[model samples]
Target: MPMIRLPSVLLLLTLGCAPAASPPTAASPPTAAPVQAPSAAADGLDAEQQAWVDSTLASLTLRQKAGQVVFGWTGGEYVAADSPEMDRLLEMVERDGIGGLVISMGLPHSYAAKLNALQRRAPVPLLVTTDMENGPGMRLAGGYALPSLLPLGGGTSFPPVMALGAIGSDSLAYQVGRVIGREARAVGVHLTFGPVLDVNSNPLNPIINVRSFGENAGEVARLASAMSRGIRSAGLLSAGKHFPGHGDTEADTHIGFAAIRADRARLDSVELVPFRAAVRAGMDGMMVAHISMTGLEGPEAAPASLSPAITRDLLRRDLGFGGLVFTDAMNMGAVIRRYGQREPLLLAMEAGADVLLQPIDPREAVDAVVAAVQAGRVTPERLDGSVRRILAAKARAGLHRRRTTELDSVEAVVGARPHGELAQAVAERSITLVRDEAGQVPLAPGRRVLSITYAQPSDIMAGRAFDRELAAGGWTVASARVDDRTPADEYARLRALADSADVVVASAYVMPREHSGTVGARGGFPALVQSLATAGRPVVAVSFGSPYLVEAFPAVPAYLLAWGGAEVSQRAAARALAGEAAIGGRLPVSLPPRHPLGTGLTRPVRTAPGHP
Candidate 1:
């Protein structure tokens, strides 16, 4: 845990009020009429826009200025604009003057309509943001459900950035970014909290598993930089998120504080690599994680979101990032558990955050910041600096001229046929053959296949698409689902089905999800698969989620990494299993000493004679 050291120039730039080294030279004679000094707003903004920003800032009360830094969430599902939720949100926009909205859950058209209505009521246009990590479909159901990042890299599967790292193609990463931006902007999303810069160095990390690009610093940096550029190219802002890096932590910050134990030197070399690359790539914004750096922040292990040393000094000054700085979410357990609700919001702004995202109580948080300002604990100049950055970002997004989305064009742009085709192609290419020790894959065309889908008991239909794809391939496929609560008798029935089948294809849907806290299979599912493999049934394990499943159940004779749980990923995996397509994906992250990084076994496309 070493301290971060900033370069002299960056330190001076970030100090905000460093004295000039020398007065204007005699060579540049001062005009007697008036020495009109350069205005602070003129640094990044044009005169007209800066004047407007200054006027707007002048017009706002301390409370309103505080509210401008607070961002609230909207699901965009309400059909009635007069609903209680809508009314509450309108109050936040019109009365509280909340500056931004993050689209948490919603339908495309309804979300657009709601945003338009909110915009009409607000004094200033809201800077709208969304997760949109995988694509607009990640949050907006009707939008193009781009394949999760791991599966998107190859051709169209929206191979996860990990796969893109494995493929080592910056161009492919750029394309993925472009698609993300295009679809996101179509739905009125201004910024995407994406291109997760965390280098998944720790295999046990629960939150950032496959969501991150990969373990190698240089590779992650290369791909993330390309993706950020693609997002910018699409006229939408891109955020390189969970910054400082959440890759090495084992805990999920959503539930509690996640600690990164790396020393400053280690962080500089590994964790901070992609972030530095992101800054160089001109990433528009960065979302600070609620992670603690033990070495940097001391034993209290303060979350980076509330740490000026981490956010302002390390990220802003040392790293030289001049764009917007965002907190991951003030509502997250890591923030609330330590600082309570209101204090974290004020602390985040003091730590150099321009946008206070997803506070537990938006109004209360704004009130606390305003009170802090009134009490002289927080300075108005500090508040104005963040407000200026937020406003500048909005202007950059063209929100000043047009804040609402075109509802009629959303459907045409989202989930467009060509994008679907591209997705399918990428998924097909990303189908990786991890192991084929027994040569069990490409099951003989007419063979009897038993497909077992393993998921939580709540997700009964999780593998329906995988089953459908196998059926469509003309295999005599029988599907069985096993969860944690399945009885011993159910296992007996499943074993009988596996015994009858010529080949057993098991789809392990142990994806990294919110609150799940683990990526490994649950409910003795892996044990059952192990039993089938022990019984001499040719078991081919296909992972629709974590690629590291092989490390958990190494006894499985054959293995495949589908990289995602998307329908396209399932179908592509099914096609690969049925010998209808090629299996060419390589492992993006290492499975430690057993299977190092870059470890996929390649196989040529196999189709029955005259089938192609």
Candidate 2:
């Protein structure tokens, strides 16, 4: 792989260490500072906190203690108090004594209200968490009151972590974490399963691509640790995830098993660097991925989340991570396909997972663990240790004092104007002009441009922001949307349309997804992008997702990378195209052979009308 072959080149691209010759000298985002000693959960517990944890753990019956380690899932949308779903969830809390919940997508007010209700019913305060990798805004896309007319409130949506990787701003990353924490806390969320610690060394990795900080382990370590600190500072627990590293694997654990074959030396140097940093940084939690590393376990590709050698020995005993250990979602294919339903939960406990997130069935999950403990398959001491950690984390988050969220405060704290501004800033700063050979940027305001958004049909938000920004500048845009399914005749039609326009702006969105299985542009997207390039019009290709897109259509004369498919990134790309924001971002990952790491061209902000 290019990542392994290009070690020397990777060192120079460390955050904040780009050479003087690189463009945009206007103070690149500050590099990560030296990490401090483990300070948060890793500090163990103060006497009062330990007492509370001990008392809480002691009070729980075997079933309740087992429930404390089993976290169920809830959709953040409003469920009437009398609804069956609410009844089921309430049963999980009241009857089974489940520890926490992993909330999926929903509105902010509804989410807060539902969580508040759950907290009120629980014997112990539930440790609410979500996969808010970007922020709560990522999952909370408020429903429209009238389809598209009246907009409901949602949380702040920042650009992806890869955008942070490209900008390399430790301060901005911290603020991203702060916004995530603040908004998440407002909605009664205590932990964000994020600041993905995966090194993103493998460009082919389908699930961890843009979710990871960057390819370089040290840079990933620095930025992720900084983000974790920011999360804790906002009074929310942060989990740096996919422990033992999910960066280098090609398969998505959501669908199938993936194995990392690196030897111990390579694993330590490349994969485990950020995790060690997280351990030292005192992150509140760590999630073990379902992927296996043969290098760590030897010969057999045992799933790390179910292997004691990886989670207990390597993570707990060897790494000394004192915080909570969460297993990756139990319902994923990596576990279920191999171990079936009930056995995985029992095995995860034995593997040393403190929290089993999103089990196939919470009732069965609780029973299985309770049965395992009774059978001595999992030790009673091991279960209690996990319960103590969970209770301590809840106490640390001040849940012991106040467990419920205020309904009125949800709208005020989430999706605040300042949070949106920060998102815009990160998006603007992260737009990297990798190749502008045609010099088509700073798109002339009066030109009749053909703007085409190439994305999955389901990516409804792909180019709306970009087109809106362009239209605001009074530019004539003959817009079209294309996906992998666009027929050849449609491409020919677009090619014909391209010839009539002065410049063709082709924006492609391709990112890591759970079941997508491949990072490359799917189906005919490469052909579609290539077709536009052959149109002879100076086609400016921009990637709103993976920066590696340039590798697929390397001949596209002009290229810009927004690093993600967020609306903020789309608007940022449009602004860069209009010269509204200075283009300074360098490549966080290499495209190989031609554009190595840190290859970016600078364009000064447009001064006056008609000026380049």
Candidate 3:
């Protein structure tokens, strides 16, 4: 395999963006000032108050003041629920006086409990935040999965709201946001750090998948604005993240430092549209990414997270966001490389970020920020500005007071009767069966069914729930996942089965990185679809990773978009296999004309008889 390399000019452009040189004037460092205790104002917050912010900052001790500006932890990911790390985390706030806490994937429920507990121990409130992009379920098991934006980005008619632009409805976006809201509020989370506004014009891009709204900048802007509607509708903070842009870059932030090299003009034309639209749509925060955009910032400086240009001039001054600004992850490679093992919380705060997403050491970081404020390196006004935004979101999420969900009945809620019914309804509605050139739907009972598959048996969990769906469904189901040694022969095994079975259903979940990759699946998938079709099986190609599989194997007479390879998708696949309804959904994104988008056939959603 060839090594992936970015273009030279692009690399140069990314490395060069820096804050223009300001002529240096000699100034002496300020000495210590008496650290006063911060107090909440007697007057209550207005319908939209900045006054509380004023008093909160004024009352904080220098150390507490710094702690208020620097967020603790990189994300929602927790270190063993209420572990020593948790105690240390509380100490950073209650004792050392840090600003906020970001709960990551592993520790959401723990975050909620600890934060609610800390409401007693700490003088100030903790701005608990999470990247509940797909809702808390994306972190914990059994949460309602809002369709990740990818599959929704592909189709016809609705055609991914990005395709619609002004033709798109903010109401529709709000409806989606409402879904996000409903899920977020149920989980006791105050903020959802997402609605990625990156423009994914490049199909081969690695990081962005359905997470992006669309390819067209205008469309992406419109759809992203819709997500803002979704965020607010849920009464949670919706953050426009990975600023200035992450989609244009190909590297994954989980592993390495990535960079975007676009010029100011280029950024405005392509990347800035959705971000501006999101701000206009009332998004509450901006999460700066670790990815470097070279010339866009000060020379020899780090990512926009710590760049004065990207945060202050562009976000606050020019765009007038006035909202909270955040860094993607203080623990990521980009920040880690510069900081080494030590925490650099003060730099992030001074760079204009109101909240730090995740950090390696909250105690040290909070102390550094405290020392910065005491030393007058960071201003009180700037610190308060960030705190106010966080408080507003907390108020909206009803986090300050006790808001309880029946956790005892949490089991009943997950895949609950009502939710499952809703899922089945949406499933039938979303089924987009494209390319039935030979009319594979509505198969008769006697037609033998051959199922060929691909999976990790990992992302889906240690045990498989899919087998249960296949076993009880009254169809002879067979599956094989692609791996280094077995994939080639598995194709033959599938073909032999396809030859015997009256209809052949082939599913693919090749890899995690497929959604925006140049080539999808392994090298052999197209061949597998081809060979199966050659066997004269009515090769029904089901895309579990993406709905765009038709582009790769248009020769297969039958194709179905399962969206993702989750339990919901599996159930939908079985229903589609049984021809439960027509594939009514049109393709949301474009593909080869041969495959055509918006290809599913399904019955219209039925209204409840008694309710009607």
Candidate 4:
């Protein structure tokens, strides 16, 4: 395979030799909010690409510019036949020329078809993107998904992305990206908001968790660069996340604001390291997280999204990132809670966000920006500048090239037999058995096996038929679901079932690292574990989300972390359970008490001393 082509500025970024950001020149009256550069000046692509972006930007009207900045989630129960919210959003595209849309969690399959229809209704073609980080099901249920990245973080042979970088196989990073890219294209997703280049140095960072590659800056940078290339080559755009860094924050932006407390100097060497690599490796866009920074703004000020100094002066001018800059979901509590249903969307634009992701109401958000422009708070020129960037981004995404797909071809493309096979293979490679103290994988023919689901049993069942796989491997499995709130009688029932079985494999699904809104894990995992812990027989804890599953419950001896709740991951777990494959994955994040992020023992099966 060909090597990844680095951006021209890679050397400066890698060496930390980037030129400093000049103080904003307030002398020139701010236009729109603040116009940085026209699409023409922004294009680093040779003359032809620059000309294309310029022509595209010039042709778009002010309404189109305003439309390009916002994307819709389209929640709320709507007309059964057609989505009322989506239809109105489409009007903004067809009548007002919106640029793109992001599909969020909790929409029915019919809703997706309606979305496809809305895209077709657009007069100026619109781009559709989704946060299919793991798989299409991440956004839409009953769709394809990979196990979370956490499982891949644990296991045996190869080092994590960090290890891969030390060897400089930018190719490995690219191959990983290729897998992501191919999977995205296969699912009709055009953009991926991942490869979280945050350099996960802090263990307590609730959100970044195993979503990041590792704690090493160079490794995170290399893999992110590789992954970005893979995504692009797959004919999609990959966005490096939290533009500056959200890794160190103890809090998650999904819930509220988090301050990094990093000065410019500290940011340069550590926090900003991965972002610099992403830009240099040609990331198509950067999503600015809702976290607050130290030197970037005042203590009482709003997030980086509302600070021109952070987004414009730092990201655009100093770092020389010229692609699309989006803010993390406008619906996030950080923006929505204080801004209280509105206003902050406009403030984000003033802060230099080219795309407003997951806005509560794109129509109203656009109108507010329009109102701001009219009121002279946001200059028309700055508005045009941001739209120019958005348009340029869409064009690069091949919005310029339209393809025809019949309804028959749609199922063939995404739901094809080959795609399923590939998904199965990836899933098999990802399953990890972190600690097999008893060495129980290769079960004897008569051994009884028990399978207990701690959380998200339904999701774990969909990817591949795990029970069937276990059955084929010559083990009898008795399966049960458990939760934190099970009554004593119910715990007794599941425990009795496990105790009766010769071996038990308890699978736990994890939450998304958000606050423990309630006291227990979803689907009563804590309760289930407590119940299972009562049984002294050999027990295995398989975590499908957090690699830290072993730490969460120290009572279990055979510990396994699948790292995600994707079908492939479960399948991989099933195959590993059957002793059909060798464990090659290791913990990507530290699991605390048991082992650090890089701990896993991969010894081969042993025979008695005189057996041979």
What's the count of clashing pairs in each model shown?
A: 21, 1, 53, 19
Candidate 2, 15: how far from true, in Å?
A: 25
Order candidates by TM-score, high to low. 2, 1, 4, 3
lDDT per residue as tens, model 2, 498-549 = 7788888888888776687887775565776676776556888888888777
TM-score winner between candidates 3 and 4: 4
User: Mind giving the per-residue lDDT tens digits that candidate 1 earns over 478-499?
Assistant: 8888877888898888888777
Q: What overall lDDT goes with each candidate model?
A: 0.74, 0.79, 0.55, 0.59
**Residue-level lDDT for 169 in candidate 4:** 42
Off by over 4 Å in 2: 1-39, 142-150
lDDT of 3 by residue, 529-559 (tens): 8766765667778775555555666577777
* Root-mean-square deviation per candidate: 12.0, 7.3, 12.8, 11.7
Point out the higher-scoring one by lDDT: 1 or 4: 1
How do the predictions measure up, each by TM-score?
0.89, 0.92, 0.75, 0.79
After TM-score superposition, the amount by which residue 467's alpha carbon in candidate 3 deviates from its true location, in angstroms, is 6.2
Q: Largest TM-score belongs to which candidate?
A: 2
RMSD of candidate 1 to true structure, Å: 12.0
